[model samples]
Target: MQVHECVSFILLKDNQVLLEKRAQDKEYDPNLIAIPGGHMEHGETREQALFRELEEELDIVPTSYVYLCSLYHPTGELQLIHYYVITQWTGTIVSLEADEVAWHSLEANPLDIEADKVALAEYRRLSLSLIIL
Candidate 1:
């Protein structure tokens, strides 16, 4: 089986999070709601892929973000996904690839992919810890 390296960003603003519905024709997770990101290109570091994907998908460049976690996912194919939390960014959002995009209540946890669910749990835990600190 072929494995791909991927990077995804969870964009947080106020009490909402940005999410997208994958393009209906996508090979994996078609029309599923998900965080924004794509596969890493050859020779790119995780952060590099993260920033590039942000720009490519949403036309935004992250000004502030942090690595959250990584997960191995098997959907249409195997994927090693790196997750990030983006707190700040520059540029207006213009969806370039997804079928739809929207801001949703963070507490709603609107997601479809199993890997995304696991990543979101980690995000919530970290956020609560930050608040408690």
Candidate 2:
């Protein structure tokens, strides 16, 4: 199995969330909008991987953070992603590794990731599940 340790941030501010348009250079999710994160290199923990990925992708560091949940790829790849809530952060957004970035009011604007149907389905599941919980 192709195990990948990935981390995604819920970059929220006053109930808004940030989503990124994937760079066309990407083969896996080109032209899609998704969260900021990537695969963990060998020997890295989930938190370390997340911090490194967020810094590389978004050019910011969190002032406070915690894990929200962990989920697997539908294909059964292990150690898929640990979702983190980044409610507080430092610095500005620059050096964007994505094609574009947008802040969405998730409550009012539904976010979408075009090429990543699995992740999108996961997002939709979370959205619906949150309403009842």
**Pairs in clash, predicted candidate 2:** none
Off by over 4 Å in 1: 131-133
Q: Could you give me the TM-score of model 2 versus the true structure? A: 0.77
lDDT of 2 at 131: 35
C-alpha RMSD between model 1 and the true structure: 1.6
Which digits, one per residue and each the tens of the lDDT, describe model 1 over residues 1-133? 8889999998998878899999989988889999888999999999999989999999999998889999988987899999999989999999999998999987886799888888878888878889411
**For candidate 2, lDDT tens digit of each residue in 16-45?**
678888788875556666766778888988
Per TM-score, the best of the predicted structures is: 1
Q: What's the lDDT for all of these models?
A: 0.90, 0.69
Highest lDDT against the true fold, candidate: 1
